[model samples]
Target: MSTIEKAMEQLNRSPGNAESVKPKLQTDELSTKVKIATAYSEKIEDKEVSVSHKKQKTLFIDDARLKSLGMISLNASMSERLVRDEFRVIKQKLLKNAFGVNRQETLANNLVMVSSANPNEGKTFISINLALSIASEQDKTVLLIDADVLSPSIDECLDLGEQAGLIDYLSGEIDDVGDIIYPTSVPDLRIMPAGRAHHMSYELLSSDRMLALMQELANRYSDRIIVLDCPPLLGVVETVTLSNLIGQAVIVVEQNKTKISDVKQAVALLNSDMNIGFIVNKAVHKAGYGYGYGYGYGYGYGSKGKNK
Candidate 1:
């Protein structure tokens, strides 16, 4: 069975019943080729540009990344417009709130782990896009990790080339996590895919090695922020484990789809107090978000420019 299929089987057996494990999950960086594939579309043919640049790789990534990457698509010009009109407005609010809440220092060190109460909550999409946005900012380095060992999303997102990563390192199949890390087209951004799922991979990360790895990562990238895209929290042990590792988390609640009951239960399951805010995902157009033009979030990268 493929890793995804195997993960499904494991989910059935585990059923997110284990008590919250200490240490947690969060997630991206990717190659230019990989990023274009993952961030753009699942279908290569969807891109009008010449795929002939197999060796061209990524020329460069935008300076600023985004939260809802899959929300809009356009030629480079259109994308830039989208970022200016849509992203900039909300981000200013995020920064102001961070400073106001006395979390000025915490937001800098935050290893935000994004997940939902269930699947298709746009957690994976949001997590990946957010990492891209962070990396774009000057002096800020961002690492996006596919910590969802049970069911990896980065590979699918980026059309990955690596055969192993987080799972291999945690299971002793690999020693150096560096071997698995891939740099994305975006400047200062890197990715660590949850290696192919093995037996009890959720349990595997709880081990001391995994804990050490996370600590090592935090120390190595003390200046950079890390984001984890994890399995849902309500019934997943790994998500709980991730919450414990990082003092902060962001629960992605998809509008309309997620039930309030599950959200309450998942929060109860998590023992961490780090959740800074609730990232409302897949939300419909609500007022107060001053996007002069309405963004129909039919919901669902990179370095070199300024906010001007």
Candidate 2:
């Protein structure tokens, strides 16, 4: 069976009626190719086009390097195949929620934040994989942002060199939004590494400048999706502050690790304006059932401290 079929089969086993998930699920039918606007500068006719949001910088990434890190396979292998298919299922759901007919009314539904209640629960793992999976799409582009200023991992995971990011733009260290965005060798995938750490990260993330940046990102290209790797919700004030600005949230709960109370507390901190969802990470795959990471749908855009 295809990945979506496997996912549907898995969801059918849930307590809620299986029919409820049919509308939310979608196959990988790519729409017509959309023109990709550059986020960085690109030369045309040898004359600088005044850097009109058309920035394209390169970050070399190897498929071998990625697989070594236990990420989804871009090539071929049983384990790699399974992981890739798994994320395909996950990303399809996310994309539907962002652009589906019944998508949430949030203005910035394309802006998604992937976070967890505690550290080391594989939140980063899921974030990176999700970005990669989305990038593989024929009709979409992705920006994997490292919003975890204090403990960013996107750069390190991809073996990128030191670079400026969201903080640099918000703090006035950088003038152009294009300056911080780095395009990866992966087609349709770009990233913004966490810039130089600042003691006032929370203040800066919640600043008016940050809000404007989000607006620009949201209103830019319709096909562009921004995935943020945010800090753990319970301990970091930045996560809560940043949550208010996003239209969608994905809370990654490590199976058998994160406490139910902690997950509830973390979800409580998010703004209800978002379409919140859950990802059960690090679960063992059952034979014939495929890998078993559950997707839980939590009610309400703004949470109120309840677990699903």
Candidate 3:
């Protein structure tokens, strides 16, 4: 009555095949054939997915190009050396907080956010420099995420073209996060561009998915560090939202430009328990020879500021 029974009956009725007619297929045999076909199909599907992932582009950051952009490069020039040394000191403290004995005190100590009181305060500059510095570490890798979706600049700064990135992953536009995280020419550096701008940038940043992604990034690798280039804290609700998910915060204060009140207010909006640091950008010493930069580490509003 069933299809298998009908096929068996036809095989038995065949004229010359009567002698060759085999016993009816056991249920397990039929099931085994179906499983083999399903497995073959699954293998084909997996191969297609793997091929698509292999097509994801790698971001190429030219050292000469970075030099032209006035950013630190792979060169060994004196000025570049000084800049690298400065970030070296900064990254040391960050690395200490990320993986040191006190690391257990912070929720996501490996996740650091670089932001400013307002835009054009050299936050992006610090973010890129910090990431580059960390990438140079012998025992660690860094993933720099452009989280300033409203005014993304990492791609432009690195001469990277538009591509799907953090937003694409957070908004469910891309099913896999690995698809947007691009490898770079730098040895241990990776980058996630701010994907296509959306009207609900704040909502997306504050979404549950964003929090889950942050948790995954923080715990994914024991030797990996994540640096988020966040928007200026003032007037950006998204930055405040992001502060909650990060374990460390670096506020870049432009010398003679950023207001003290703005710094206090921006700091007020951040997670009070976070390890906070300040970078005085473009500060000039009494001699007025070259730009003097200073780093101060603190905790919460009652921070014991120690300049390094």
Candidate 4:
């Protein structure tokens, strides 16, 4: 048997203990170094789980609610002109990094994540808005995944009803990831809610199942962009584990809110090899300072969006 086949066989036969079952990374040959408890074996079977082939469930989003959140205009053209312009610039950088330009290959560009040093820093707000903008792209599709299993807010933000989500599939409550991925009323945009919070959420996120699911998402569609709204980088074990599965990381820092020392620590949690960037959530729109025509929030893009 080939080396990969033998490794798979060994993985399947071993007790599901975190130490015994090491899942291979989807993007690279190395395995995850995060130690995950093996109790998930009861949920995961020997057979491989396929996500790309399955049909997904569809959910409707409330446009009015999104408008109230300043996400989009009533006419559905990005609500705040300033917000839209800023995000346009941000997404441009991200897309170029994802698809590459002029034959230059971008590394770990498709799988992008939005995180922060702490809660209430507007990471969720930025994540949802970024997904919305990316969905507007002509050729690309976007999947916004709520990786914050501890305190999920995507469903609530989108005004969605209770539904089975990522946790259900990871815990084996559902056999297919397509069942958990919900296509939204918004065209070209889909979402995966955090689902029922599991006590072993951290472990499950770092498990073989999680790795398999991420691999499927990353490789299934060449033009697909996954925007993960992960938990805070510091003080969250799950976020650090989830970071290993993605290619690029966008750290959101609130102006005058998140401390500089905290931001440093949060960035340190991610793998050094990954491409990392920042987005200043709230900034004052002054006379100059790169501020364009008047808009909302005075949100500034600092040091490539590093807050002042």
In model 2, how large is the Cα lDDT of residue 299? Answer: 18
List the lowest-lDDT window of 10 residues for candidate 1: 299-308
lDDT of each: 0.51, 0.66, 0.68, 0.66
Q: How many clashing pairs per prediction, in order?
A: 31, 10, 0, 3
Off by over 4 Å in 2: 1-51, 104-106, 283-308
For model 1, the stretches where C-alpha displacement exceeds 4 angstroms are 1-75, 79-108, 283-308
lDDT of 4 by residue, 1-308 (tens): 42223322332343322223222211222211222223433333353765655676678887766655656432555324445555666677667657865312424458888998898777788888889888888999999999888888888877787889888899999987778888888899999999997899877777778866776676678898999998888888767867766767777766556776786677667765555656655433333222222222222111211222
As a whole number from 0 to 100, the lDDT of residue 28 in candidate 4 is: 24
Query: Would you estimate the TM-scores of all the predictions?
Result: 0.63, 0.75, 0.74, 0.74
- Return the top candidate by lDDT: 3
Can you write out model 2's per-residue Cα lDDT over 135-171, one digit (the tens) per residue? 9999999998898888887777677888888888878
lDDT of 1 by residue, 16-71 (tens): 21221111111111001101112112332232211121222332333222222333
User: Which model scores highest in TM-score?
Assistant: 2
